[model samples]
Structure formats: structure tokens, C-alpha cells
Target chain A: MAALVTVLDLSLGPLTGDNFVIYRSGLRWLVSDGHVCRAGEPIAFCNIGLRSSDGEIRSTAPFLREQTDFQLTLAAPMPGTLHQLPDASRGGWLDQLDRYQHWSESFIPGSLDITGGAGNQSRWRLIFSAGERMTELAEDRSGRLTGWRRIRRAWHGERSDHGTLASLGTCEQNGVFLGEQHDFSELLAASPGSLHVIHVGDENLVPAAAVLSDRMRRDAGANALLAADMTQAVLGGPVTPGPADWHYAGSALSALTRCPLSERYDLLSRQGLSPSVAVNAVVLSVNAEPKVILRHRKLGYRAYWHRFRVDTTGQAIRNWLNVSFEALSRTIDDIQTDLRELCKLLAERGVKHVLIMNALSTSGGESIFTYAPFSQALGDELPSVRMKELNLMLHDLAEETDIAIVDVDSIAAGLGAAAHLPDGVHQSGPMQDEVRGEILHILEQRDFFAPPRA
Target chain B: MLLELSLPLINPHMAHARVDSILVRPDKKIAIGQAILELTVDLSDQFPHDCPPVSYYRLCASEAAWLRHLAIAAGEKAAVGTLLATFSKTSDEAVENCASRALRTTVVGVTRQWQPW
Candidate 1:
């Protein structure tokens, strides 16, 4: 008898842009490492410098600046552990400016001492000694000091109450520096799993599914045999497949997993965000399990929500959906055919099992009132109704083929409209949990604890 | 008593790996948690890159014993749990006896240098 294969392929195809981390500019971190935060909680404060139209620094004080010039706080987009980037690793707008300034100077060793003062104010005294010259600075909080080289050039001239040459136009306000304006912090903890995640949706499903998959794999034995590629059904139209391009969905997945691409098409398609010719390449590649890659092909899918100018009114979107319903239906059929072929190929490759997740559309509900026209148009066709048709198709395919269906729509509907954001398609944490629960349930039923092949 | 030291399944996805370099030498005394060898696992096909997935494993020895046999050499591919070496608590007498016995056992017509007891 041949050795038993114990590899599981977990794929999360394209998701709507929900899983992508948005790195904003001009942030001063307030959260500590390993701090758990809820979604929408303020994690950091923005201390963006005010710049004039001519690109000159307007004010040095961030607190005294106008709201237009400085955003007060930066909030966590999702709930998870906050892994703050180290201060040395921080690089952003301010770092760029510092690099551009190219001020070269040799700095002597500095010593920091904390001194307690009146009114519960503790002062930090930083003393610097260069050659025979000694400089002392006092501040309530310690931050990067600037213009020191220029002040050092004029230090012999005079002394002021601020301890520096005030006549040289160097004051504490002008010298004070805000360290890092913007930096990145990962929210999720390191999930324990060997299963690879291949994301294929726009942005809606991937983030939640990735988090859930990590948890699920941990619950199942560390070395259980399982393989699955959860491909998201086409939401709107049939995209022509050719000319390798890179998609953010795929690039993001690849970057997250750190698994190198096996085939050139996977690399080209992911890098260019173009239609992929080798959709089945991952399944075909040997030892492909426990790897995560995205299978997105739609162009401009990431920014689709923000670019809704074509249908300012609900009427245009409604007319477009109504008119293109046939094309959309045909595209669904093509997708179904492609999936069927993929399942057949996977089965032929000696894959013991395969699981397919049904696609989900937004529930228009009352949430549409927030973005009236776009929301109204999305609700017009009852997107869930159309998605249900695809779901049923998957069910029929499951009965006829080796594929098993995980009904994400029923799960999403049970959560109601509020479970989703304004986009209607993207889900919040609760909805993500429901979807993950269903997948875990399916895997459990499939006998995750079965003995390895003899 | 004779003890066999075999490769461990460091990664579930890994089937077989090439011995990059042996950190321990034959007849050298080793301790628990001491790195014994470095294995270069192929992840090139999965992730096309110049760098391969390389990992080092430490010996989980139950007792102090002289390193006796080297069934695998550097650049040689070995399956998970393949007998790499053996140790004896008593003396080197068992090592000579085990090596002679291993010479007779054949896998696919190739004589194996170390046998798992």
C-alpha cells in the first residue's frame, strides 16, 4: 500500500477589500504591544503637521492646529491583538522628510534622567556632551529634537532662559519633533495552522475567513488531513481571462502567507491583477497544501465600491442590472462550468475531499438609506435572491460531484442586514463567525479525526 | 540496549527533505536540545524563489550516548522518520553488531546502513 497523504488545501479566493489593511498617514501610536482592541476603538492619535499650499510647514503645535490640518484620532478597523511596529521600524511621511533633509552631523552620547516637579509634572532632562561643550534640555515629555546642529553652530553667542540660543531662532517649540507620523500595526495574533489559505473573492469574505480558518485549524488536530479551495462566485459580470496581471487580493494573500508562487501564471496574474489562465494551477501543484494564495481576476475590484460614479442615481444601476441580468446569468453558468471542471480535476488528482463555499450578496435592508442611490440600486435586484440561485446550483453540483457545499447565504441571512456593512456584501465580525462556524461544522462532519491511511 | 535516532516530522506538509549539513559528528557526545542536523526542505515549487525552506532540528535524546551511525549523508534526501543514526548505552560493541546487522537488511535491493529497532 502507498503512504497516506495527510495534506489539506484551504483556499480563500478573492474577497471584497475588507481584509486589506489600510495604512493611513500621520499617526502617533497610543496603544501598547499585545493590546487587544475592539473594532472602531481609537488605537492611535493623528499628529499631522499643518502644511500650507506652498508645502511649507504652517504650525509646529499639533494641538493648536485646525481639524482640517490634523486628524485627532486613528481607530482600529477590526478587533484583534495590536502588534505595534518597533520605533526603529517606523517609517512614514516624517521619516521621508528627515531623509530628504540630509542634515549630516556627528552626535555625542546623551543621557536621559527623569526629575519630579510640582503639579505632578515629571520633567525629562537630556544632557548631551560634545568635546568640551555640554548642553542640557528640559521637557515634560521626551521627543526627537530638531535644529540642534544649527543651534550648536550659534551656541557660543548667547544663553537664554530656555537654555539654548533663542536669538538663533531655535526655541523648544521649533525644536520639538513628533517621532513617527504613520506606521503599521498588525491586529491579528499568530494563528496556528499549516493549512494554506487561497482567497478568491473581492474583499468581503477573505479577512473573516482567514481569521476563522486559523482558529478552525487549531481546533482540529494540528496535523489533520484536509484540502479545500473556497472560490467566491462572480458577483456582477464575466471577466475575460487572459494577459497575466496582478490583483491586490492575490498579492495580499501571497504576502500574508509567504508562500512563493509555483507557476508563472499565478505570479503574473497576481502581480498584474489580470485574468488568470491557470486557476487550477494551485491544485495541480504537488505539496500545495497548507499554503494561502488569492485567486482574484477582476480588474479594479478592490476600489469598486469607492468608484460608483456611473450610477449616481438608483435608476442607472437598476437599469444596468436589469439589462445585464442575462449576461450575469450567462457568466454564472460559465463560473459553474469552470468550478465543475476544477472539482473534477481535483478529484482526479487523488484529493480525498473538496469543500465549496457558496457566494453571498448584500442584504439591502435599511442600511441603504445611508448611501441612498448606491444602496437603493443594490437593493433593487434583491442581490441575495440572485445569489441564492447560484447557491442552489452549487447544491446540485455537490449532489452530482464530490464537492460539498457550505451555505454561507443562509448563514448571512440569519444574521440579518446589520451584520453587514454599508456595502451589503462585506460582513462584520459576527457574520464572519457564522460563516466560519458553518465551515468548521462541515469539516467536523467529514471526519477530521479519521485514522491515517495504513 | 540500542537506541535509534530518526528524523522527526517537523512540518506536516513536509514529506521528505535533503540533509543540508550535519551539526554533530559520529562518535561525538550530544545532549538534549542540541542541534543535530540542518535539513533543507524544498518549497521552491510552492514558492518560486532562490531561498528554500530550511530548518534545523535538535536531538530529543532520552539518554547520553555516543553518536554511532550516519545512515544519511549531506545532500541525500530522506523520508520522515528514516533511521539516521543509533546509540548504545552499554558500549561501542553494540554499534559494531548493529552496523553488521544493518548491512544485511535491504530496502529495494539497496543495503541500509541503519535499522530502526
Candidate 2:
């Protein structure tokens, strides 16, 4: 029997900006040619750059922070085998730099041979990815979303009025949202409506409730004071900072000063460049809420870094951290209060949905038969006990606020934590898929796809 | 009866584990259910990156016994099935015997509130 074949032209659709020319580099194929692709699977991507029509560039230009690494990943509109045109791409700088060709709506670089079906779709569904590099010197063009980005984001759907979901969780959330490729493959395939996702790295500073709330409310004077104090500490400290230390200081300062919750986006859609307001939904992780955080003795700001990450820093920054910060313990009530304040501030910003991913409270390898030898205050000493307490507190907070728990505890438990979540933190592939489905379900329940609020 | 302490597979993704801290001293009586060893399994050891998949675990004694010999120390990396320590039912039992089996232990995942710095 002969397999039915239909050619579906993959054309560059309407990608525009006001008084600016949007140019794209040659196609960078994610998958090899003749590879069968699933529907909505990202197959190829290209670097996109914006240049002024009048040859005038300014610091206040739109997407100034993201213009350096702006890109668009093209997804397969339907299931088919991808076949690129012979002159589709010229390797080297011709494919690396975005100044080679202007974006034309009718430009067809490739065609999909749909097997056993006839489809009329010709326009490529765009998945836009942008990264704000930690430093301009850290240029890595190895793969999509590569290099050191202080903030990385991607969005899909052609509608200008898209609902944005900001991910401010730990690595657990990172795997679920960004997938194994770090290009949002699973999320893009699953999300049917207009959706935007932004992920902020937690390598330098964990985005706890205290840190996030502080970032949301910090002012210019406070930012100036923080920058000055950091500068003095790293430059004039007892130990001289090396290149590694300076790089860490710069990236850490950038993470500390920026407020992701209040960030606006310059979105490129089928119509043109549309300015998006703050995110419609924010997802956090209960795992990020530490029981103790470091507070600067003189500056009065809070900071927390993963133990492994702190060990990797240079001696100068380590010395600064050890001397300049004091440890403050937080009780369950304190965590609840911080979350409450964060939700209040977000609500004031007109955000209606706050989905928090609860921690996985069970371990497959654990078999604690007794607590006779353990500390008396189990909730304070044991990780599982404290997580249970925190999860309960989140349930209580949900009753009083618009916060919704993503309920990873229940989901992991239901899916068999031993096989899915081995160490109680990082999840397996099946586990991540389940978490992604639950997140999208929660968004659907909250009507996240409805028209944007005025 | 003599018992041995060998590294068990704590995390599925980890091929080797590091001895973060050993809480028990050899020749001392360790109570059942008491924490005896702290181990760390970092996936970054296998897949190196900035934000590694690191986890902490504590191994508690499942049977009361006299600690006999220690084979590993803190800051040492051991592969799975490597003997970590030895124990005996009595304090003065002969330490050289191959008739006994691995020690019974209960592994618990833990969290550290402070950083190494």
C-alpha cells in the first residue's frame, strides 16, 4: 500500500514591529531532515534582530535587554516529515547572525510531507524565545537558550492578548516548565492557547517569598544603596576578588535588583510588536521557602543560596557572605505571613492567579521506624516533618487568598514517588509530564485563556 | 554476628556518593535508629552543571551494635557496594570474617539550613 503524501508549505508568517525592520538568520534545524515530527513539536529556530528604519538606536528601545538573544523556534503545525529547501540555510555567520535576511510573510523555507493525511496549513506556528544574558561577554551559540541568562523566557500562540505565566520556582519547576531541552518543548506542545512562560534562575539567589516581595517593592534609593554596598564589599573586602568572583558578583547583583513580577514584555505576534503587561499567573515552589535565610547585618536585606552553589563561589564572595550576613530562623507562621504579603502585593498589581508548587513530602528509600533517637521537635529538625507543616500552611493560606496550590505532593504520591521522584526533589521524565499536565489544568480551571483584563 | 556497612543506592540517578559526615566513632555503641552517617549524592558528579541535582541523606542504624571498623571517611567518594564500615554484635568480637552480611540501615533524606561558607 502506498502512503498518502501531501506537501504542506512552511512559511514565515506576519512578524513585525513599528518603524523597525525585523531580520532573521538562516534556519537552525533542531531535528534532522526527514525526521517525523509530532504536532506542535519545535523543529527549527532562527535568531531574530530588530534594526531601526532610520538607523537610530537608543538604550530606551523596545526589547533592549532581550534584543541580543532574541529568537523564534518554529513548531510543526501538524504531524509530518520535515524537508527543508536546498537553499534554506547557509552555514556559519550567515546562519548565526540575524542581519542576513528580512522576515517575509510569504517566505517558505521548507515543506512538510504529511503522510496518510491532507492538511491545508502552510503558516508556521511561532515559539519566541528570548534570553537576557548575564554578561555580554558570555556568548554561547551552541544551542537554543544556551549561555548564561539572568532571565530566559518563551511564548507561543499568535494572539497578541496572551496570558503570561511566570515561573519563579526551583530546579524542580525548571524541568517541568523548560523540559529536558531547555526550549519549552513539552510546554509548547501541551499549551493550546496563547501562553507565555518566564523562568528566572535560582543559582545565585533563591526566589523565596521574602526575596520576591522585597524585589517587588524595592525603590531606586534602596537599589542604589544595595549596589553601592555590594561594590564596596567585593572591591574593598579583605580578600581580593578574582575574575570568577567578579562574574558572580555581577550576575548576583542583577538577580537581586530586578523584579520579575512587575516586568512588561515586548511580544512579537502575527500582528506586530504588542506590549504585554505583567504576568497573569505566577507559579512558585514550596521547596524554595527556606526555614532560615541570611539577612545582611548592615543593609537589612535577605538572601539565600543553595549550599552546593555557595561552595562553588570564589573566596572573596564567600568571605563577604560569611561576614556581612546573619542567619534568621523562620517559623511556619513566618513563612505563612511572607506568602500572604507576596499574594497581597501581586493582587495589587492586578494578578489574579498565584499557583504554588508544593514540595514532595515523601521519600521512596526512607523507612524511619522510630523517632526515639531523633530530636524532640521533629517539625523543626526533620525535613519531611517541616515540609508537611509547610504544605498544611499553604492549604490554610489558599483559603484566605486567591493562591492555588499545584499539589505536587498529592500528584507525586499518586504516581508512586519511589519510581518518579527518587530523591524527593528532582523528578523523572514521567513525573515532569504529569506535573506539566496539572499546571495546564489549573490554568484552564482559572480561565487563563479568556480575554486579557482591562 | 558481624555486620558490614556498604553504600546503598540512595538515588537512582547517582552512580557514586560522597561521605559528607560520619556521626559515629568506631569501638562505640550505636543505638538502633540513631543516625550514623551522612551522605550526599549529587547528580552533577555525573552531569556537571551550575545548578546540580544534589540531595542529602542520613543513614541510621537499624540494629544496635558495637562499631568495629571504619572503611571510609568524610569528603570521600564511594561507589555503590563499597564497604563504608563494620560492626559486631559484641564489642570484642573478631573483626576479620566473611560470613556476615551487610548492615541493616534506614536512609532518610535531610535538608541543611546552613551553607558551607
* Counted clashes in each candidate structure: 37, 0
* Candidate 1 lDDT over residue span A1-454, tens digit each: 6534221111111111122211213334556656675644445442222233344433431212121222223344344455554431244554322222211112111111112212321111111111101112211111222211111111000011111111100011111111022111111111111111122221211222222223222322221211111012212224321222113223322322321121111111011111111222121100111112222233111111111222222332323223322211123454456456645544453334556555554333211212211222222223343455566667777777766665655665676644442233344555555544554355446543222334
Q: Which lDDT tens digits does candidate 2 get at residues A185-214?
A: 788678757888888878767999988888
What tens-digit string does per-residue lDDT give for candidate 1 at B1-117? 566766655444456767766767887776543445555455343555322333332233434566777788888888877988776554454565543221111110001111111
Best by lDDT: 2
| Residues forming the 10-long window of minimal summed lDDT in candidate 1 chain A | A153-162
DockQ of each: 0.00, 0.52
Give candidate 1 misplaced runs (Cα > 4 Å): A1-192, A200-335, A346-354, A359-385, A418-424, A440-454, B1-117
Candidate 2 residues lying further than 4 Å off, grouped into runs, are A1-4, A32-35, A115-120, A451-454, B1-32, B35-49, B53-55, B61-105, B112-116
Candidate 2, clashing residue pairs? none
User: What is the Å distance of residue A77 in model 1 from its true position?
Assistant: 24
